[model samples]
Each structure stands twice: as structure tokens, then as C-alpha cells.
Target: MNTTPSYRTIAGDGLWSNNLGLVQLLGLCPLLAVSGTAINGLGLGLATLLVLLGANLCVSLIRHWIRPEIRIPVFVLIIASFVTAVELLMSAYFHQLFLILGIFIPLIVTNCGILGRAEAFASKQPPLPAAADALAVGGGFLLVLVVLGGLRELLAQGTLFSQAHLMFGDWGRGLSVTLLEDYRGYLLAALPPGAFIGLGLLLALKNLIDQRRAAVAKAAPALTTQQANTP
Candidate 1:
């Protein structure tokens, strides 16, 4: 068995093939709800990334001792503990953002992205590879959250990082970029329906790109064969 996954495979997993948001479609509840604003999405995504890394490391470390029958429960318990710690820490330090995030903070424990990594990769691998996989998967999830959040924020509010201080400290309060002074916020883009529409459009775009790539590959073989035959 190959112990190491290649750099190409890692990049593909993080960017496209096993993308947490567009492909796995995990953690949609928090992904859709908090993605109304760029800062909100960034905050949530970073927290999730931390939790995933911690959980993956713990699971990988204990993979040998854990029996098959009890592994899932063990993983969930570990994840839930980390999430609770994160929730409390956020509430204490970033009270405003914590309130804004609300239940979604706790909901991170149940996110399929974290749990899936524990079951699929960490349970079988050593600490280093498992950590790498967690990073790739978590990074992928964060990429989607940030992109969707940026899109929604720009369209709905005509601003980027409008409320950065809510997550970051006082310095971030003035970090917002105003794209339009006389802008009317689009209610549709800030709503749940908008998330579905945006996600669907993104998925469609990805599929279209994949199809084009596939077509080029298919045509290349035919063209090469024809050229060989002609000569």
C-alpha cells in the first residue's frame, strides 16, 4: 500500500476532486448560513479548520488502540470536545462574533467534513499523513466558504470585509472596503435561497469546466490517431 499521497493528489483534493464544499458538500448548514458575509464565513471557516486538524491528529494518534466497533464514537467524542472548547473560547474572547455565529459554532462538531476525515483517512493513517489530509480538506472547505461569502457580500452589500472587527479586533474595524456608497443591499443574496442558487451555479460552473477539459482530452487522442494514420 502506498503510504504517501503525492503533492498533485493533495492539490487536486484541496482544489477540485475532493473539494469539501462543492464535491463532498459537507457542512452545508454553517456554510450556507454564515456565508452571507465575508468576515462571518472567514471566522467560521478558520474555526472549522482548527477543529479538523485537531481531530485528525488525535484520531490518527489513536488509530491503533481504537477498535473498529468503537472508533466512530471515539472520533465523535474527540471532535465534540474540541468544538466545545472552541465554542467557549470564541464566546469568551470574540463575544460579538460568537453571538453572530450562534448555534452554528456548536454545529461544527457534527460537520461531516471533520467526521469524514476521521473515518476515511485518520483511522487508517499515521499522524503526519492524516494531518496533511485534514489540512487539505479543511483548506478546501475554507476556500469555498470564503469564495461564497465574498460573492454574497459583494452582491448583497456592495462591501468586502464590512464587519471585520466583529471577528478580528479593533484594527479590523476600519478594514472594510466599500464598493458602492449609494448601494441597495440585495435581500435575495443574503438569504438561504440565495445560498442554494449560488451553490448550484458554482457547481454548474465546475461541471462545465470539467466537461471542457474532458472533451479536449478525448479530441487530442483522436487527433493524434488521425495524424499517425495519415503519415
Candidate 2:
């Protein structure tokens, strides 16, 4: 009755092969909206991950108790509970980040990646695997957000971790790196339109990398067999 996925499989699916932003293409709204800076993306990503982690654990524990007919609703309610907790925490500690991210923080409740996992993986798997899956998936999502945020911030303003204090308070202000002191910022890269452009370019880069890896994998077996036959 154990439906736990292997660690490799879980990691691959959650981090790369089935990522929410890059692969599955879920949660695009916040993925593109709040990622104007590294801290913004990191904050939201952490929130989403926290909610996913708690939701998956809760769903796995109650999976058998809920009737099949109302399972979806039950799963949603569970996710909402976690989202509420996450929202409150953010509002309390990272009040500045909470204001900047605004509605996106609360909207984590509607992200399909969360609900999809609850129904597909967590509901069927044991608690340990479910938690692992959530971690992998959330890590992947957070990574993409961070990378995207970094890309935009660096390209637009020639800085890294700009406005990090919003998340880390006074100490975080010191972490902001000024890569280009006099660099004129790129207007497009600082706007919402820029997120789409950056994301598209990132997708192209990922696809190129994937294609090269696939080709290499495909050629390896053929080359080995040919060498063996020749000998």
C-alpha cells in the first residue's frame, strides 16, 4: 500500500522535470509579477514552499479519512489553512515584504501546483515521501523565482539583491551588491513586460540545455554498442 516515490524521481520531478514555473507552467501570475527583485521572489517562494510543506503533510495524514466525493474540497480547505498561517506570519515579521508582494501572498492558496500535488502525490503517498516531494517541488519553484528575479534585477539595474532589507531588515541592506555604480537601468527590464521577456529567454535557454543533454544521452548507448560490436 506504500506509494512513496524514489528520492531521485521525486527530486527530478519537483526540481526540474516537473517544475511549477518552468516545466508545469503553473502559478505564472505571481511567478512573473512579484519577481522584480531577488528578495521579492525569495520571500514569495519561501512562503509558497512553507504552505506546500504543511499542506502536503496534512493531506497525507487525512487522505484515507476523507470520502472520495469530497476529497478535492477537503484538500483545498487544508491548503487554505496553511496559506492563512503563512500569510499571517509574513504580515507579522516581513511587513515590508508583505506590503510589496501584496495580494500574491494570499493568492498562494489558488496555485494549482499546490492543489495538484495534494491530489496526485500527497493524497496517495506516505507522509515522508509526501514531505520530500513538497520540498523538491517547492525548491524548484523557489529556485526559478530567484533566478528570474536575479536576472531582472541584474540586467535592469546592474545590482544584486536590491531592496533585500525588505526581507532581512537593516542587515539585508548591507547585502545588496552594487555591480554597476553608474549603470543606466534598462527600463524594459524593470517593468512587468520585462518579466515575460526574461522568462521567455530563460525557457529557451532551458530547452536548449535539455535538448543537448537528451542528444548526448541518446548517443551514448549507440556509441557503446558500436564499440562493443567492432571489438
Error of 1 at 218 (Å): 2.5
Which regions of candidate 1 are displaced past 4 Å? Answer: 223-231
Alpha carbon lDDT at 75, candidate 1: 94
Question: In terms of TM-score, which candidate is strongest?
Answer: 2
lDDT of 1 by residue, 1-231 (tens): 637677678668866888999998889999999999888888898889889989999998988899899988999999999999889899999899899999999999889889988998888888888888878888888888888898889889999999899877899979999998999999899999998888888889989999999999999999999999995
Clashes of each: 0, 0
Clash count in backbone of candidate 1 = 0
Which 10-residue window in model 1 sums to the lowest lDDT? 1-10
